[model samples]
Target chain A: MALLGILLFLMIIGAVIAVETRNLLSSIVCLGAIGFLLSIVFLFLGAPDLAITQLVVEILCLVILIRATIHRRVETVAGNREFVGLAVTVVMLAIVLMLAISMMAGFPSLGTSVLDRMAQAPSHFYLLQGKAQTGVTNIVTAILLDFRAYDTLGEATVLFCAVMGALAVLRRSARRRPEEGDAGDEGEGGAE
Target chain B: MSGGTHQGGMSLIVRTVTRWLKAFILLFGIYVVLYGHVSPGGGFAGGVVIACAYILLTLAEGRERTARLLSERLAAVLAVAGLLFFLGVGLAGMVGGRAFLDNFLVGDSGAEPALASGGIIELCEIAIGIIVSMSLFLAFAVLSRFRVSLGDGDETATGEGGAS
Candidate 1:
C-alpha cells in the first residue's frame, strides 16, 4: 500500500512533467517513466504478467512517439492546437482512472490460493500427462506452452504481423531497391 | 550552423556517457528477456530494451550501419520464428488428443515449476520480444530518415530536424 501511494505520487509527478515540458522528447521520456512506475505498482499488486505486458506496450508507445517527434522541432508548440490535444488527453486519462478505481474497489481478493486450485483443476490434470510437454517446473509455463500453446502461437503470429506491418509502413519497401531488383525496371515503373 | 562535420562539437563527456548509456540499455534488454520468468521481466520487456539500445546506438553512431545490422529480412525472420515456435508447441498438444496445445497426454501437468517447465513460456516471450524490438526500431529509423530527406533544401526544416 505504501508502495502504491508512492507510485501514485510519482505518477502524478510524471504526468505534470510530461504535460509541462516544452521539449517533446522530455515529455515522451516522462510518459515512459510514468508507465514504468505504474507497471511496478501492478507487479506489487500481484500481477506480474500484467506488469510485463504493460512495460512492453509502453516501450512500444515511446518508440512510436519518438519517431513522430523526429520529423519536427521537439520544443515547437503548435500554438493553441496542442492545448486542445492536452485537454483531450487529460479528459481521457481522468475517465480511465475513474473506471479503474471503481473496478478495483468492486473486486474481491482471491489471492495465490487460486493458483493451487487451478493447478488441481481437470484442465491441469490433462496438462501434466502430455507427452510432448517441455519439462518446465512452472505450471504457468506448462499451461502457456503445452496446454495453451495455441493461444501463445496466435499471439506470436499477431506480434510478428504487427512488426512487419509497422516496418512496411515506416520504411521503404526492401524489394524496391534498384540494386537488389532489376535496375532497368525502375525507368518503366516510374511511367506507371 | 554547427553542422561543421564535427558532431555538433559535443564534449567528450557527453559522447562517452552516451556510449555507456547505449551499452547499459542493451545489457538491460538481454537481462529482461533472459530472466523474464523469475523476475518481473519477460520477452516483451527485453525486446523493447533491445530496441532502445538499437536506437541509442543509431543516435550515437549514424543510421547506415544500424540499418545494415537490423535489415528487413532479419526482422521478418524473427517474426516468422516466433510464429513457428508458438505453432509447434500447440501442435504437440494436438497430437496427443486433448485438442490443440493440450499437455496432459504429453505429461506436462505432472511437471514442477522448475526451469524446464518455465522454459517454454520463456521461449515464447523471447520470440515475441524479438519481433517487437525489430519492428519498433525499423519504425524509428524510417521516420527519422524521412524527416532528414525532407529537410534537404530548407533552412527551417534543417533547424527543426536538428532541434529534436
Candidate 2:
C-alpha cells in the first residue's frame, strides 16, 4: 500500500513537472517517467501484459518525441496564454478527481471482484471457458484476439489514422525526381 | 541517402552496439509476437518492440541509412498490406461462416499453450504485428524528416521544400 501510494505520488509530481518544465527535453523525460511509473503500478495490479505494453509504448513515445524535438528550435517556452483555458483545465481536473473519489465508494473490496461477487460476470466466463473456447493459455490474448477482436481491429484502425495523419502533415516532396532535386539545389546555390 | 538534410549518426560505440543489439531485439520481438498467445505480450506489444529495433538502428545510422534499410515507401506498402491481409482474414471467415472477424478457422488444430493452437488468433496477431510495426516505422520516418520552417512567409509553409 505504501509503495503504491509513493508511486502514485511520484506519478502526480511527474505529471506536474512534465507540464510545467521549460525545457522540452525535460518535459518529455518527465512524461516518460510518469509512463514508467504507471507501468509499474500496472504490474502491481497483476496486469503484466499491460505493464509490458506500457513500458514498450513509453520507450517508443520517448524516442519519437525526442527525435522530433531534438532538431527543432525551442527558443521560447510557450504557455497557456488564455486564462479561460487554464481555468477550464483546472475545473476538469477537479471534476475528474471528485468523480474518482466518489466512485471509490462503489468499488468492490480489495480482495474481491465482479467474478467473485456476481455469478454472470464475463470474467468468470473467460476464466472458466476461455481456454476451452479459444484454445489459448493466456486468457488475455484469448480475450483480445478471439472474443474482442473488433476492438483490436478498431485499435489498428486508430493507429492507421495516426500514421496517415503524420504522413499527410509531414510529407514534403515524397516523389521529387532526381533532376528536380538537383535543380532545386542549383537554384538554392545560385540564390546563395 | 543522397539528398536529405541529416548529419552522420552517433559515435562509433553507439553504432557498433546498435549493430549487435538490433538483431537480438528484432528476434525478441518476433518471439513475443509468435508466442504471444502463450505469453504476456500479444501482437501490439511485440510489433512495437520490432519497430523499436528498427528505430534503434535508425538512431545509430541516421535517417538516410535507415530509409535505405526500410524505406518510406516500403513501410507504407507494408502497413497497407498488413491491413489488407487482416481484412482478408475477416472476409475469409465470412465466406465459410457467419460474422465478421470471427474465429472460424480456429480450433480442431491444437490444444492450449502450444504454438499450433489458437488458429485465427495466431494469424490475426501476425497481421496486427505487421500493421503496427510498419505504421510506427512510417510515422517515425515522417516525423524525423519533418522540418519546421519559421521564416520565408511567402514560401507557404505547406510547399516549403524538404528533400524526401
Candidate 3:
C-alpha cells in the first residue's frame, strides 16, 4: 500500500510536469513516465497482462506524439497564465481526492484480503473452471478469447475503423484535388 | 536536418544497438504470443510487443527502409487477414454444431499447462495478435509518411528519418 501510494504520488508529479512544461518533447517524455508508473501500478494490482499492454502502448504513443511535435513549433505561453491553470487543477484534484477518500469510508477498507472479499464473483468462477473449460492456463486469455470473445471482436472492429479513419485524415493526397491522382507523385514512394 | 544526405537514421550508437537488439525483440514478441496461454501476455499485449519491435526499427532505421521492409498494402492485407482468420475460427466452431468461438479441440488438447493445451483459444490469440501488430504498424507507417506543407518550396519529411 505504501508503495502504491508513493507510485501514485510520483505519477501525479509526472503528470503535473507534463502539463506544465514549455517544451513539447519534455511534456511527452513526462507523459511516458506517468504511463510507465501506471503500468507498475497495474503490475502491483496483479494484472501483468494489463501491465504489458500499457507499457507497449505507452511506447507507441510516445513515438507517435514525438513525431507529431517534431516539425511543429512548441506553443509557448507568453505569460504566467499557465500557473493559474495549474493552481486550479491542483485545487480540483484535492477536492476529488477528498471526495474519493470520504467515499472509501463506506466501502471495504483498504488492503483487505482477497479471500475476505467477494468470493462468489464471476472472477472466482472463471479461475476455478477456466482451464478445464478452455484448456488454457492463462485464465485472462481464456476469458478474453472464449467467454467474452464478442467483446474482443468489437474492440478489433473499433480499432480497425479508427486506424482507417486516421489514415484517411493523414493522407496528403486526400487533401489534394481529385485531378492530382494523375500526377502520380502521391503513390507508394510517398513514405520517403 | 541532421544526418543530411544520408537519410539513414538516428546516431551511429542507436543504429548499432538496434541492429543487435531488434532480432531479440522480435523473438520475444513471438514467444509472448505463442506462449500466451501459459503466460501473462496474451494476444493484445503480445501484438503490441511485436508492433513495438517494428516501431523500434522505424526509430533506429529510416522511414524509407522500414516502408520498403513492410509496405502499407501488405500491412493492411495482414490486418484484414487476421480479422478473417479470427472469424474463420468462430465459424469453424459453428460448423461443429457449437456456438461461435467454441473450443472444438478439447479432446486432442495436450497437457493442462502445455503450449498445445488451448484448443481454439490459442489460434484466436494468434489471430488477434496479427491484427493488432499489423494495424499498429500501418498506423505508424502512414503517420510517419505524413508531410506538412511548409510553403517554402523545401517540403522535407515530417517524421522518422530526420525531423527538423
Evaluated on chain B only, what are the TM-scores of all the candidate structures, in order?
0.67, 0.82, 0.84
Candidate order (TM-score) = 2, 3, 1
On TM-score, the leading prediction is 2
lDDT of 1: 0.61
Deviating ranges (above 4 Å) for candidate 1: A16-26, A48-60, A70-105, A109-147, A172-192, B1-31, B96-98, B103-123, B147-164
RMSD to the true structure for each prediction, in A, is 7.4, 5.0, 4.9
lDDT of all predictions: 0.61, 0.79, 0.78
Count the clashes in each prediction. Answer: 28, 0, 0
Error (Å) of candidate 1 at residue A116 is: 12
Residues A73-105 of candidate 2 have per-residue lDDT tens digits of 456636668989889999999999999999998
Q: Model 3: which residue pairs collide?
A: none
Report the lDDT of model 1 for residue B109. Answer: 36
Superposed Cα deviation of residue A72, candidate 1 (Å): 2.9
Model 3 TM-score, 2 decimals:
0.83
Per residue, candidate 2 scores C-alpha lDDT tens digits across B34-87 of 889888998999999999998887777776677777887888889989888888
Q: Is the docking of candidate 3 incorrect, acceptable, medium or high quality?
A: acceptable
Better of 2 and 3 by TM-score: 2
Considering only N, C-alpha and C atoms within 3 Å, which residue pairs clash in candidate 2?
none
Best by DockQ: 3
